[model samples]
Target: MLIWRLQKRVLNFVHVPPPHCGVDIVDAIYKCLKECGLKNKVFTVSMDNASYNHSCLRFLREIFSRNRRLLCKGKLFHVRCCAHILNLLVQDGLGEIGHIIENVRESVKYINQYEARKQTFSKIVQQLQLGTKKLVIIDFPTRWNSTFQMLLCALKFKDVFPRFQGRKPNYDYLSTPEEWKNVEKVCEVLEVFNVVTNIIFDSDYPTSNFYLSEIYRVKEILNLKAMDESDFIRRMVGKMKGKFDKYWGECNLLMVVASVMDPRCKLRLAEMFFPKIYSEAETRNNIEQVRGDLYQLYMSM
Candidate 1:
C-alpha cells in the first residue's frame, strides 16, 4: 500500500501481506500511521469500493473515534474512490449493448491475431493513404474504457474494413452500418467519463474540489441522453442512471463542502445546482444543511 502526504509532497510505500481481512487491514494501517506519528492527524482515507475495504475503514474509524485528540470526530473519514465508481457506472451502461460490443471486439481480435492479417491490414491502410500507421486496438473485456478506445481507433479505419473483408471473404465479423452507429453513440458517452477519470487521477494536484462539478456534469449529461430520441441511447442511459444513483445519489458531505469552499463558486454554486438535482423542498434543506456543515468544519479547524 502507498500513503501520500499532500502538503509535504511525500509518498510512503509499505509492504502488506495477502489475504487481507478487515481487521488485518485496519491493523496494518493503524500501525503504519502510528509509526509515522500521524495516527491522530488523519482526517480521511480514500479506497476502492470493495466490501472488505469498507469494513476495514469502518474498523479504523471506530478506533479513531475513541481517541479524544482526533478532530472532526471521524465524521469525514471514508472516501469511496471516485474512479472506481466511474468505472462501475460505465461498465453497467456497456451491459445494455454487450452483444454489439462483442461483435466489435471479435473483429479486432481477428485482425490482430495473425501477422499475415496485420500485414494485409497495413497494405490496406497504405493503399487508402490514411497517413498513419496506427493499428486497431484489441480491448480487454474486463476493461470498459479500453473497449471505448478500441472502438474509437477502429472508427478511424472504418473505410478500410470493407475492402479488407472483400479480400478475405471468409471473415464475416465486419460491423454493419447500424452497429457502427451504435459504437459511435457509446463512444460519445464514454468519452466524457474518460475525461473525468483523467482529471481526477492527476497525481500532481488535489482533486477533491472537482468531484462536485464533474459528477454534476455526468448526471446532467445522462439526464439529457435519457431524453434522446433514439431508443437505444435512452435505454442505455437509463441503466447507467440507475447505477450512478445507486452509488452517488447521496454523496459524501465533505465533497460538497469542499466545492462550496472554492472561492470562485462559494455558496452560489451549491444554490444554483441543488435545485436542479433535488426537489424544491429538499434543495432548500440540503443547502442549509451544507451551510451548517461548512460552519462546523471552519470552527473545528
Candidate 2:
C-alpha cells in the first residue's frame, strides 16, 4: 500500500505459496517494491500484531539495511495497526461475556430464521411501540465489533424480548434480567472501542497525535472502570485492560515523537498524561526519551 497527499493505493497483492514464513513474506515484498521502482523509497510498514509479522519486519529491515536504504536506522519502520490492536482488546472483553453474547446471538437468529417468527416479533415490537426501525442484528462471531453492534441493537429491544419469549415458548435464549443488566454495562464499555475503531478506519491518514489522543481516551476509561464496584464490570474490564497493556503499555516511540511534533499537542499532552499512565520515574524518563527521539528525527531530516 502507498499513500501520498492523503491518497492511498494498493500497489500489489501477492500470494505466498504456503508456509508463510518471514523470509518468504519479505521476498514477496522486496520483489514488489523493486518492481514498482520503490525499493529505496520505502518508509514504514504497518501490519497487525502477529508473531509472523514481527519476524517479517526483522527480515525486511535487514534487507533494507544491507542496501543502506534504512531511515533513522529503521527505528520507525514498523507500525502495529491500531485498529487491529483495538479489535484484540474488544475480543478479550467479549471472551468474558461469551455466554451472554451467545444467548443474544441465538435469540436474534431465531427471530430472523423464519417468516412466522419475524412477523410474531414485529407485532410485539409494534404493540410495545418500541418505535425502533432497527431490527435485531445477527453478528459475525469472528468480529467482536459486530458483536458489539449486535448487543447495542439488542439493548433497544430488551423490553420486547421477554414478551416474545411468552408467545414463543420454544425460544430458550432470552437472557435473564441479571444477564441483561450485565449486557447493558458491557455495551457501555464496548461503545468506546467501537467508536475508536470506526474513527481509525474511516479517516484517511490520521496523524500520530490523532492516534495518541484516541488511545489515551481508551486508557483513561479502562483505568476508571477497573475500579468499578460491580464485580461483573470489573472482571470484564480486567480482561480488556490486559490486552490493552500488551499492545500499549510501552508507548510506541514513533507515535510519541509524532505526537510531540503535532502543533496542537507538542510536549504538553505527553507531559500531562504520562503521570497518569506511568510511574513518576517512568513518566519523567519517557518524556525525556520522546524529547531525545524527536530531536534525532528532526536532525536526521
Best by lDDT: 2
Model 2: residues with Cα > 4 Å off, grouped in runs:
1-4
Q: TM-score of the candidate numbered 1?
A: 0.90
Cα lDDT tens digits for candidate 1, 1-301: 7554567434366566877778888887888888889888887788988888988988888898888444445557887778888888888888888887887788788888888888888899999999865576888878887898898988888788898899889788888888888889888898888888888776676777787888888988898889987788888899999988887776457778777767778888778877777778888888887877777778988
Name the 10 consecutive residues with the lowest summed lDDT in model 2.
1-10
Segments of candidate 1 deviating more than 4 angstroms: 1-19, 69-73
lDDT of 2 at 93: 75
C-alpha lDDT of candidate 1 relative to the true structure: 0.81
lDDT of 2 by residue, 190-247 (tens): 8888787776678667655667777888998899889987787888789989998888
* Cα TM-score per model: 0.90, 0.94
Whole-model lDDT for model 2 versus the true structure?
0.83
User: What is the Å distance of residue 35 in model 2 from its true position?
Assistant: 1.6
Candidate 2 to truth, TM: 0.94
